[model samples]
Structure formats: C-alpha cells, structure tokens
Target: MAEVHTVYVPRDTTACSLGAEAIAQQLGRHLAMHSPDCRLVRNGSRGAFWLEPLLEVETEQGRLAYGPVTPEQLPDLLAAGLLAGTTEHPLYLGPVDDIPWLRRQQRLTFARAGVTDPLSIEDYRTHGGFVGLKKALSMTPQALVDEVKASGLRGRGGAAFPAGIKWQTVLDAPADNPGNPQSGRKFIVCNADEGDSGTFADRLVMEADPYMLIEGMIIAGLAVGADYGFIYLRSEYPLAHQVLQEAITRAEQAGWLGADMQGSGRDFQLEVRLGAGAYICGEETSLLDSLEGKRGMVRAKPPLPALKGAFGQPTVVNNVLTLAAVPWIIDQGGQAYANHGQGRSLGTMPFQLAGNIERGGLVELAFGPTLRELVEDFGGGTRSGRPMQAIQVGGPLGAYLPAAQWDTSLDYEAFAEAGAVLGHGGVVVFDDTVDMAQQARFAMEFCMVESCGKCTPCRIGSVRGVEVIDRIIADDNRAAQLDLLAELCDTMEFGSLCAMGGMTPNPVRSAVEHFPDAFGVTPESSAGAA
Candidate 1:
C-alpha cells in the first residue's frame, strides 16, 4: 500500500464557509512537498453543513471522516502522520458511509453527489457515471421516455408531477403550422431559482455536480426532441452560478454539450440565465417571464409549460433536482430506480434538512420516511436541544404541524392530506422557543414582499392578513380580528390566481388553529369578523 493517501473535501457554498477550499489547498501542498504518496481531491459537499470542510481520508477502515478543518493547523497535523491514524482527530472515528444520517439516505440523484470530483470526467466515469448517456445514445427518444415512465419518478420540485408525462406531452405536441397552424420550438427550461428558505439542495447540486445537471439536460433534449435548454438560476447563489458556467464550458469543450455532441447528430445546447431575486420565479410560468427579461409574475395555467411555454412553444420546465435526477435514471434501468419509493411517490428525494435543528443538512430518502424520523432521528431535535413544538414541512407555503402530526409520511399526497405540502422537501424545526403567531405573521409578510401585485387577493390580501394577525396578537378586537382573518384567508385561497395567493394562508391557518393561545384570542373573539 502507498504510504500517502487521498483526501476528499467539500466545495459547496455552505461547506466553503467552514473552510473546505483552504483545507483542500493546504492538504494538496502538504502532499506535493512533504508526502509524495498523499494526494487531495476537491469534491462537492456531502450536504452535511456542521461537518463542513469535511476531510475523507482513504483508509483500511474505509473513508474516515474529520471535519471543520482550518488551514493553519496543517503543518503540525501533517508532521504527526495524521493520514496514518484515521481515528486520531476529534471529529474522526469511523467510515463516513456508516454514519447513521448518511446511512439512512437512499441517495439516487445524489449517488455521486458528495463522493466524486464533480468536474473531472475521469473521476465521474470511474464512479459509474455517464453510463446513462452511453445507453441513451443507443436508444430512440420515445423509448427513453418509456423507460422514465417505468421508473415512476415524479418532479421533486414542489408539484410532484409525473416527469415522463411532461416529456411525452412535449414530444406529442402539434408541429408549427405554416399557413393554417404551425408547431412551435420545443424547449427544456430547468427551474434553478430555489428561493425557499431552509432549502439549499438545488444550489448544492449545481455547485457540487454541475456537470450532472448539464448531462441531464442534454439527455432531456434528446428525449423530448428539443435543441435548446436553459437553467434559470436565482441571483443569490453567486457561487452556484459561477460553478455552472465553468462546468458548461468544460462539458462543451469535452463534446458533452454544444452542437453535434460527441459527433452524435443531436444538436443540443444549454445556457444559464439569472433571475432578479424573485421568489415566485420558482414557479414555472413566472420563471419563463424572468427568462424573457420580464418582471417575474405568475401566469394562468391550462396551457401548461409542457403544452405552451417559453415563447408559446412546447417545453418541459422542471426543477433543478428533477432535471439532475434524469441522467442517473437513464443510466440505471427505470425499474431499478423506481423500486425504492412507496405509493405515488417513487425514488429517493433529496430533502433539505434545515432551520433551528440539530444535524441540519441534506437527507436523501425514499418517500415513506416519516416526518418523526426526519425531525427526531436525523435532525436530532431542535438546535437549542430543547423539545420541539412545531415543524414546518415545505417552504413558506407549507403548513405548520404540531408535534402530534410528526408521524405523517413525507410523500406529497400524504402531506397534502395532512394539510401540508412536501414543497421542495424543506423541513424547518422550531423548538418551544418559537412563537407560532410570529411565524404566521412572517409568512404573510414574506408573501406581501414577494407578491408581484398582479392579483387582487395576493396583492391586497397579504397586507390585510398581517394587520389582522397584529390585531389578534395585540388582544384588541381579538375575536373580530380572528374571524376577519379566517374569512380573508378563505377568500384568498379560493379567489386568488396562483399558489402565491392560495397557499399563503397555510402557515397562518395552522398557527391559529393549533396554537390559538399564541394569538391571545379567545373563542368568543373568533365569533364575528370586523
């Protein structure tokens, strides 16, 4: 065995803050001058924030883990033969894969995530990557869509729509008619505007495995007969944007992108576009508007993005995770990938475990994992180590469930039945310290700030909702205010144009229903609307 060894460190934005890059550079220098056998591989984050700058050393015991390393300590550590003793570091003890949080993950889309050097084609190839592209090159487009359908994968982005159905719709659309009617251009738009708080999965994937997204888009283009693809990214993720740009350049130069990819007749090209910090842009049509350089506003449905999107063309607009998962599904057989999940939800979901929680990180799992397991076992309870009171599943649009409902499964339909949503799989845990009324008010304030003001209920209703919450909290006209708020929420939910208006009441309603004491409102106070 070589006296020297290789180390893997995360480079995702979250990991970088914990000093991942500096650690990698220091380790590399040490390997170059002092230890000829030692090498270092700068890898994408493993999605574990607290253990960032995590060093995974190749050892007889497997990949030994140590983390949150700083560059200044390299010399003494290197001199001590740290590579030889994998368990010596305070953070080191056992194989990283065997760690309970990591072990529990189903890891399909994220199979190569924290494990490989994301940019190196050689590294990716060595780890069973690009096999999907190779297999896809051998099959026809229709056959490819059929394979996806067999996999039973749905969009991991909030909606949980069937991915294969969207592909088929675009493939089967009517061609542009010259005189009487004509088929429009086919497009594949990747929704990378991940504006939800407590959710960084999309940004993590783009920063860590940019090539995967590009490869997935290329495969989608081939599957849907589309020549052009666009990734609509949020401006907040500057590092992710930069990383993706570099990856696209690398892939294009490597014959993985651009016209006539690898001498194959497929003429697919991809480009990245930045969104001007609009939360609604995460929605498909609003994303299209931002791509076209218009204000990000929700548009009507019926002619879904699949039927008419991006300049009135047949297009497939999917989320970052949804698109990133494609290459893997293609490489592996559909049944092989589909066999992991339960019920209507299939395959592993890359859930973003964040906010006021211990062991906060990325957790990829099959659909049936109960919220209780995610919060108690994986999250390890609240960050304050206090008993948790409420947990919010999904984004701001999601419902706040009291601890009694923790047993509910994480699937989309199950969450919907429980008056919640698995929107982008962001689970935020709040301990007893949390004020439910304040959280409820913050939801409305977020909506008010983000609402494009295109619709009456959302534009006017959110401000009123916040005022009503304030009135209820102040204990003045409490009963009338509570009644008014309920009536207002019902109006916005039923009369609003899009989810922005419709679902904003979820947090408010749940807070009011579950913890009425937080609002300081009596039962009689809810009797009449002011």
Candidate 2:
C-alpha cells in the first residue's frame, strides 16, 4: 500500500476537458526523476468542475489543495516543495474540506466525494462504509422503516415526500404477490435521469461513489421487503452509467450485494438501466413507462409510484441522491442527519450551482441557507463575472426570481412561498446579458418540444406561446399582445394536467411581472385595449 501522503489529480470529464491527464503524465515523469518516495493517483472529480487540472498534496497539516495547476507550471510548484508543505502556489488552499463551498455542506451522501479513489472498495470501507447494511440486517423489515421514519429524510428527487413513508407503503403491500421476499422478483429502482439542465449532483455521485447508490438501494430493499433493484440512469452521462455498472458488479462479487447480502440472511440484487435521452422520463411514472418499454408520458397522480410502480407492483422509486443519502443517515442515526437543516426540509441538500453562475458545481448545504448566499457567495456570481440580474431556482419548471427575492431560504416550503420550486435544487444564474422575454418564451418552447402530446394545453398552448412572445418582442400590438400572453399563461397554469403544462408558465409569468420593459411593449399600444 502507498503512503497516505500522495499527489492526486481528478480525472472526471471536466478535469479531462482541461487536460488533467496530460498533466498527470508529465508529473509522473517528474516524480520518477526527482522524488522516488512520492506516489501519484488519478482519481475522480470533486465536482468542482471549474477547478480542473486540480492537484492535491497530502500535507502534515491536511490534504492541501491547488487547482487548474497545469504541467506548464509544474516546475515552479515542484521547486516550491509542495510535498514538503513549503509551497505557496496561488492555487494552494489548506485542506479540501475547509473550502467554504465544500465545507458548508452537511455531506452525508457526498461523504466520500473528493477524499477517496471512488472505485476502490477498501477506500470506501476505511471511511466507515457498509455500516448501514450491517445495522439494517439486525432489524426486521418493519423496524428498518421506523428507523428511517425517525431520520426525517424526504425524497431529494424533486419531490420532498418522506422516504420512510414510501418504504412503509411497499412493505404494506399484500404478501400474495407473485414473488416471495427472497425470490428476487420484487425490486427498487433509482431514478438517475436528472434531466434538469443546470443540475449534476446525481451524476457526480454516481461517478464518484457509485457504491453509495448501490448500498443505499440495498438498504431500501431490506427496509421495504424487496430483493432486487435497478437504477434507470440517463444515456447522456456515459461515464456515470459505466461507473455504476462496474460498481454493481464489484458489489455483487464481493457479497456486498446480491443474495445473502453481507451475510445478513437478506437477498438483494441490483443492476443499471439506461434511458434514451427523454427529459419527460424523469417523472417517476413516466420513468416506469419508459422502463416498461413504452413511450415516456406523464401519468396522472393518485396512485403514486410508491403504491403502484414498475410493472404495476408495489415499488420504491427514489432519486439517486435521495437513496445515496440513506446509508449515512442510517449509519450515523436519524437525529444526527435530521438536525442539520431547517424545519420541514431536514438534512443536507446537494445543490447544483451551475449555468451562468460563477461557481458551477455541487455545493451541498444545510437547508436554511439563503439563495443569495448560495449564488453570490458560493457561486461568486455569473461565469462571465457580471452582476446577476435574474436567477431561476429549481429546474426549467421553476419561476424566475428577481433579485429582490434572493434572500429567500433554500427549502421546499420557503421556495414555494416565493412562487418557486426548489426542484432538484438547481439554481441557474443569469447576468444582464440575458433577455427576459427570450427566457420566458424558451420555457414554453421547452415544454412544447418535450411534451408527450397527451394533452391540449401543453401541446397547442406552447405553439401559440411562441407566436405571442414574437409579437410582443417585435412590438406588434404591444399592449394587446402582452395581455393575450398573460391570458395564455393563466390558462396554462390552471388547465394543464401535469407540471409540464401547469408550471411551464411559471418562468414566463415571473419574467413578465418582474421585467416589464424587457418585453418591449409600450403604453401607446394600450389605446387598442379599449
């Protein structure tokens, strides 16, 4: 085994894009020529995409960090004695965890994020991994659910529904179902679609600590009396998909998964299923539809996926983060996890700070943090380094929050009060360069293009929406067009079946209300209103 004190670089897509690999190759030559005692490891990313070509040295003080450190600058960094802790590289920051962006996060699901060689089971076990499964095996299935109930964990899959309650529902299903608890026929599925444009937390977790997701699924299966699991991940993330499959294989062969998991007398099996790039399939029912080999269309609510899911049997459908966080909660006890966040939104949230934002990466935080602190302080404003004009919280279905509402806390209920959703905890920043009218129209256009075409309001309403925005933008019948646009938004708000139709107007309506001048409408056109 190599010494803990080693030089490491991230090899995730973002780092690779910035040539971290080439830097590693160069550093390997330098290390062989100079310090034979030094070891270097190419590891997965820390999810800090912007800090690519990042270098870390295990220092006596802690794991000291430096970033965007290219091979071109290696001579200086080496001469400065990075290994001896005498380096003052501008990128050198003491302890990766001490960084405000990474430190503030509660990090149950992200416990192993930047610290370990992601694919190594030994690294995982050394960090207190698999404790949840060992603890779960000692309890009855019903008792396991009760422990989760005490943990105050809500689904992180855009819906804040309680995870324990969902598990209870599956356990309550009749025992007469086709398969016995040990038969491996019943299953749990992780929804890794994560189609939200600005969000990448789930993908990062899978790429970094895929076994956490697998372990979480095994715990879900144990608690809910299921014997098998499937993770329906998106195809766009080939790296995540590949990493997850390899993790599953490793878990199975090591007896961490599959029948007789960890010698607990429990039978559980897991696998990965890839999605063909349909955003609509992120919806739980729609995900099940796609999993069943059918078109991905949103199904009406009433019988939630927890009750009747995946092949019409009782199933637990959870987001990757939601499931990934379970092992930590269970291992450390419920109260330790529950005490981290604000009321109603308990536990840490892996907020994906991206898009026009300056700090574009995963920032896990306690729930009470304000959106302003998240976007400005952690994100450091827009990528272009301009003052933020408008911000969209949640995904595209969310509202366009003006600068005035930036003080709102990042919680489900708090965001709901501002007429926004913390859907998937994605905050997309926009500078003054963004056109509000264009952004509004793009929301409806997204809905129109992605709509399953099952209903009228979303299908027909979206096409008309494009024309109305064009008219408003072109200054044709200005006031009348604005009023007409408002009317159409109202109809979409109340008339649509699912969020696709119902919430598509949120961005448009908020944009219109907050930035009226951006619409390019004038009072003179109001003369026709009479």
Candidate 3:
C-alpha cells in the first residue's frame, strides 16, 4: 500500500489568470500515471502573486513550494522528483513558511489563507476556523462590542472610522421593524465593492478563506442584534461571487450560518448582492440604495447608516477587511490584537503592492513600517529597474507621494499629517518614466467618469478640473491656470458631498507641488502649490 500525498494548486483569480488551470490539468494527468494515490487540491493563493501558480506539496518535512510554473515545466518538475517534495528541483522554494517574504510580518486575518481548501468545511474547521464565532456565542453582545473596541479596530475601507463605535451605534439604535416592535430587524452590510485601483484584499479574502469572512459576518450580526446580512459585492469580481455564494450554502448546511447556527439558536441569514460596476457604490449609503434595488447614489448623513440603513432599519456597514478582522478579535481577545500595531492604528494592515513594482503582491505588516521599507525591501523596487519617482498610497484619489515623503510612518495619523491617506492599504509604485501631469489629469478624469452625479461639486467640478489641467499643461497662462486650479480644488474639497470630489484634488495638488516641471512650471515659479 502507498501513502497518499497532497498537491496544492491555487484556484484564485490571480493564479487562474496566470495559467494555474493548465498547470493543474498537466499535473493531474501525470499524477494519475505516476502516483495514482496522490490527491490534487485546489487551494487559494498565498498572496505572493509573483510565484503563482505556486505549487505546494505536503511532505513529512513541511509543505514545499514550486512557483511561477508553466505547463511545459510540469514534466521536468515531476522528473526531478517533485512528487516526493524534492528540493533538487530549481523551482522548489523550500518550506512555504520559511520564505522571507511571508515570514517577516503578522498574519492575523489571513492566517488561514492559502493554507486550506477554500470551500471545504472540514478543512476550515481543522485550521481553527469559526473559533472566534464560537467564542462570541459565549459572550454578551455588549462584551463583544467592547472587545472589538478595545482592539482599536477601525474601518479598513478608507474612512478609518472606529468599527466598535459603529457597532455600538447600531446596537443602541432601537430595532424598529414597523408592525412588530420586538422584531429586531437591523442589518449587517459588508462592502465588498473593491473599485479602488491597486486594491485586491477584499477579493482575496472572499476567494481564499471565505469562511473567515462568513464567520466574521455572523459575529457582526450577533453583536448588532441583526438576523440578516448582505455582502454588497462588485460585479467585476465574478470569481469572488461564485466562491462566496458557494461558501454561504456550505456554511448554512453545516449550521454555521443558518437560523440555528451551531445549535446556539442565533438566527442570522446572509446573502450576496451584486453592484452594477459603479465605483460610487463603494460608499456605504450608496451601497444601501443599490442593495434595496435602487440606483446607486449617496445619501446625506445625520440619519447615519447605524441609525437608519438598509430599508430604513438600523444597520452596520463595514468593508470586507474590517468585518474579516472581527473573528480574530473575538477568538484571541481584543487586547491581544491591540498589542500588534502602533498608536491608534492597532492591528496588521494587508498592504497591496502593484503597478511598476518588481515583486507585486500583498504584504501584511503592523502599522509602523515606512513606505521605503515596503517598496525596496518587500517590493524589490520597480519592475523596470529604473529609479522610483512617486508612490500613490490609497486609491486614485490618494495623494501622489514623492521620494522625500517615503520615510513617513504608515500610521493613519502620520499619513494624515503628511497630507495623504492610508486608504484601503493600496500602495501603487511608479518609475521615473511616469508623467505626473498626466497622472494628475487622470485623477480628475476618473472622478468625472465615475461620479454618481448626485452633487454639483463632483460632477461639474471634475469636468472643469480636467480642462484646467489641460490648459496648465498646454502652457496657456500657466501661473494663472495653476491659481485657478487651486481655487477650484478648494471649492471641490469643501463643497463636495463625499470623498469623490473632495479627494480628487489630492493627486492634482500633490503633483503640482512636488513635480512642477511636469506641469510646465518651475518649483520657484509655480503658484498655489501645496
């Protein structure tokens, strides 16, 4: 009799896009002929995307990795004793856990990612899944809220609002279900609409360790006295949609998500609602409108979502990463989670490195490392091997940071003090070849295209912004145009209804301030520069 071995090939979108499916098929045929007893497992990516289709083989020593493999290389890999987990193969990456890229930082929320079969309930449980939810069931709702608050967890979805405060608001807001005073009809909404450029953490969680998200959502539902939840997923993420829907069905069948969750008598029902590719729907209020089958548009605050949301009921609106962090807080205790980060930005941030980076992927670190460390140490500098000129933290609306600002700490307050944002933890790199003037123009153009047209500042102001930038670049009354651009940015920043219009000026102003030559003006001559 032969011992059964396991081979893991990532089925996540990144891996599949990089020919993981072809590699898997090639491996399957070879396995059947050579080692019939061995099993093939379709797992999630380890977030080291440069190494995808990263193949892992479980052995007595540890899980060994071989990566960036092509279908043509499969025969050579097998011939080099790949099935026996041989390090003799050039592609072998030693123990997966020992990789410097993965070993350096903390992985609380993503602890189980790329480790287990994403849809397997038994595998999920074996890897400490649902431990947080089980613990949450033993505690009172107030205690749960307090635990999250103590952890100092803030919204990971750009705004950085305290998650515990939002939870408390929904908890304190009386549940008004119309005819039934005791109906308790509050809702939990997970904003999975990851429309920001260079952001994929939300999609990764949904595709990799989906149960973590499901468990987190369940915990949120229990804490807020809500029996129903909806994950407002973006239409662009078809793979995430399929994985989440399947995970939900499996969780319900296993009693982790149904009316009687794990026999605890909790009645939380969850579903996924798709958004119509509108970037504005990433906003909580606009997401609610879309969830209710209306056009995606922003709603005025004061009647906050925590007070009246999702069909005129009190609601908890949090993004994927924010909710995904809950189970860890509950399972490990709030203070334990709080002990990881710096200042008010407690807990680890899964920073996504993209654009011109050499080793572009996810790097989850505590909130203290400078941008230089992330780009040079982890990212390995620019893919073009050229000098790095600027880095755009957060999304398109985030400020374009120059090399002078690279040493700034990654803390929320630190970034805020530097006139930038740590939005969604996306760090997009740019080489010296990048055109700052064109980049600034695209920021306004993007806003003009994506704005919901709900407010004058976002709709009309963005259009005017593009024209002003064009005139500035054309050198038509350069200083005067720059001054006018500054005034227009001031209007949009103060008068806009949301960050869409407000933050559009971030890149524009930063570019003009840092790289005046790109805008046809010298630093000494540029007027109204930040």
Q: In model 3, which runs have C-alpha deviations exceeding 4 angstroms?
A: 1-4, 177-183, 528-530
lDDT of each: 0.83, 0.82, 0.91
Under the 3 Å rule for N, CA and C atoms, how many clashes does model 3 have?
Answer: 0
Full-model lDDT, candidate 2: 0.82
Better by lDDT, candidate 3 or 2:
3
True-vs-predicted CA distance for residue 315, candidate 3, Å = 0.4
In model 2, which regions exceed 4 Å deviation?
A: 1-5, 29-37, 79-86, 175-185, 522-530
CA deviation > 4 Å runs, candidate 1: 28-33, 70-80, 177-184, 522-530
Q: Please report the candidate that would top TM-score against the real structure.
A: 3
> Clash pairs of candidate 3?
none
User: Clashes in each model (backbone N, CA, C under 3 Å)?
Assistant: 10, 0, 0
Q: Alpha carbon lDDT of residue 77, candidate 3? A: 87
RMSD of each: 2.3, 3.0, 1.7
Error of 2 at 99 (Å): 2.7
Residue by residue across 3-38, what tens digits does model 2's lDDT show? 345888776767767888788888788788877788
TM-score of 3: 0.98
Error of 3 at 396 (Å): 1.0
Residue 448, model 2: Cα distance from true site in angstroms: 1.8
